[model samples]
Target: MKINIPNPMFKIRAAAAILKAAVIPSNLRFPGRALVFLDMVRAATSEMAADVGNGTKSDVLMTPVTWLQDAIIEAPIVALDPEGDPIEGSELIALLETPNPFYSLEVLLAGTTLSLAIDGNAYWIVNHGRGGEKLPAEILYAPHMNMEPEWPANDPKKFITHYEYATKGQPQLIRPFGIDADDENAGVPGNVEKGLSVIHFRKGIDPDNIRKGLSPLKGLLREIWTDDAAASFTAALLKNSGVPGVVISPTDSEVNMTPEEGDAAKAKIETQFGGTNRGKPIVMLGPTKVEQFGFSPAQMDLSALRNVSEERVTAALHIHAAVVGFGAGLQSSKVGATMESMVRQSWYSGVIPLQKIIAGEVTRTLAPALGAASAEFDNKGVQALRENEDLKAARIGRLYRDGVLTRADARSALNFETVDADNVYLSNLATTFIPQGQAAPPPSNGNGADPKGILARLQDPAESLTNLLKAHGFASPAAMLAQLGLVDPGEV
Candidate 1:
């Protein structure tokens, strides 16, 4: 009666166990580095050109995106002191105005920061031109694709950087970070400590890929898939009218054909009548009639489907659809004079944060050298100047009334130059009352005389009335009452 049996729990555990061989291969990862590398290149080269107009005019001009990038780069950003006052004509401001030989301060800062904002990574090579000192003479943009970052001992901050660059007909060479401007051995490696300036910009969540910033467009790959599907649907709209699958017709009903004959007939019909031939007249031979089958995208409204993909792109860019003329329904939402205000508010709100980030980076890097206590970025040309006149006036007036700001501060807030007289503060006065030094005028009576003499100079209005009928509808209150009562019209 003895028998060997496997335990039910053991069998269950064996069935549920994950085998090493069953694990997914590393190569089978859905998205590989190749796609990310490609996107990095695209982001780097996104604003390469601007198109102003048709032909040469347009060719010479920059595109909207490029223009926007340039504006951000070239914007006149001033450095402010600890008191929020601009430090004009300072070395720091000048450095920011023009960072390097090839590019202006605005351009360098804008381009680099934008690159970091959009692509999540940017690099710069600090060149100490002429007599080598700690001060950075020129900051040059280094291509992310060309630079291979190395971390010795797996330290995030400690890294040996080399840039692989080659011109036409020249052998590709690895150039190390921080080569002396005058050094003949600049192209050779081993200059790691001398010139490496690597900024992480924005860190990604994945510790394994800490060197690279998490791209804002990382979600775009999924969006692109939806775009691809939409494009395919559109193409299908042209071919099969959005229908999927083929039409099968029972052979003419009157005549029978072999499989070869049926296939040949189908091919012949397709070549002559499919795609562009759709909606055209069809002439039948004998009793044969053509019939269409299967469901198509056009039948289900292709535009409605495509809008979803368009919205995904809009959301990824974090821009208003109206800015690029993209409407909620395949066209941009209605843009009018009123919408301009909304657009400006949206744009400035987005830009100010980036501006602050850029300013912080610049100040942190250059403040020590420039001998400045602290620095702040001025939004002068951007928001301060562009504010509505009435709104600006109201803001200044409110501040002046509240005594929270001096006259000079109010004027400065309104973008006006300060006057010596405007510098005085009236903080001691009640917020609702005028200041102590300023004299308050006495209260005026209805007559232009002292309030005490008003009763003495009074006169009867009836005595002054020479023309009774012209002056009043009735001569007096008593006369009017008599006409209506017993004293009658005869007495009048």
Candidate 2:
């Protein structure tokens, strides 16, 4: 006997096999294009505004808050349709389609879900009622003028005529919706109409449909149903869905689950409910306790977990206590003091009050200049003048006496007087070609510097010879070193 078996996807009458489940279309719908397009507008405007604010350009004042809110309001209408046309009735259509941070957005006509016009924010909130639904209708004006302080406060004068023409007054539409429709939000100004941004839902939609469509993805996305029958079943659920697209909000996602946490959660599903979905909720991809330790996610029925043991559901409570504890302690540490608090510390008493640390630095740096001033000018007051030119000359002369501030020194100090005389000079060879200079002036023994005694211990071999040579007035370090008889060939 020859027996024939029907293939899984063969729906007898329709004779159609949906072999593969279609992709869950992205929220933006068209692959990466929607997001890319969205970003271009956001970034282009954001960048231009940021550039203006950052001083890369001028005459523009852009606060990021204003920019972000505007972007949210403007992004959808400006997005282009695939054929290079601006989307039809763009404003209203795009609003419904465009997502917000928290939920789906749409310019709902008060109570009903029927889409309104995008042609112009040309909205007429007409009172509407059909079947059992009724909504109050009103005329809602869109952003009207393209110029002046109409949109930008500063540029008010830029389009005096345009703003004057458009903004005669904000008026409330005598009727909000068609006779049976409900006016969702109260209206403008003191009337039943107002110009306000609102976020909410349409009334009278099937609760079950909302649950199936607007509801979060009930199970983890798992199991590519390869068998044609199973694939077709999955496809049918999506194909028949009331909502044209899937729109998920961050809130809808399960508190993120670890694989182990998920596995333990899922293993108990069968015992709590029948092996197949008929016993409880039948969500696509099946209820999942997806193993989050980097394995493929499993579709899980969390309702099943309502009866499952807590042992399968574990999450960290104390594992990070140490890190948070350390951060809290650090936040209170002394280094956390504000700059003003640190700067004012010298006015108070404490262990090297932070201000002392700073003042000590100032004094330490200014010591040479101050001390030299005291020595040459003979007093601390600014009015004091150098009593003796030789003393003044000595200070300037001592600048070189220590060593003529070398080029790198002058450039670094910006002037010889303020330069720390102890800086290592190209002339660091000291007595090698010159007389035993007053033991190269001692260094301030402060901070963590290596003790300055190293200079005291070193005596140049050429110091005595140079002194004898200098007695003959060889004049300069270079001239003395270059003299034929002065430097021995061996030394060279």
Best by lDDT: 1
Candidate 2, residue 51: the lDDT equals 36
Q: Candidate 2: TM-score? A: 0.14
Local distance difference test scores for all models = 0.48, 0.26
Candidate 1, 181-282: lDDT as tens digits: 234322224543343343333424323354455655555554444445565666666676555555556556667878998889889878787888875776
Off by over 4 Å in 2: 1-424, 428-492
Best by TM-score: 1
Per-candidate alpha-carbon RMSD to the true structure: 20.9, 31.6
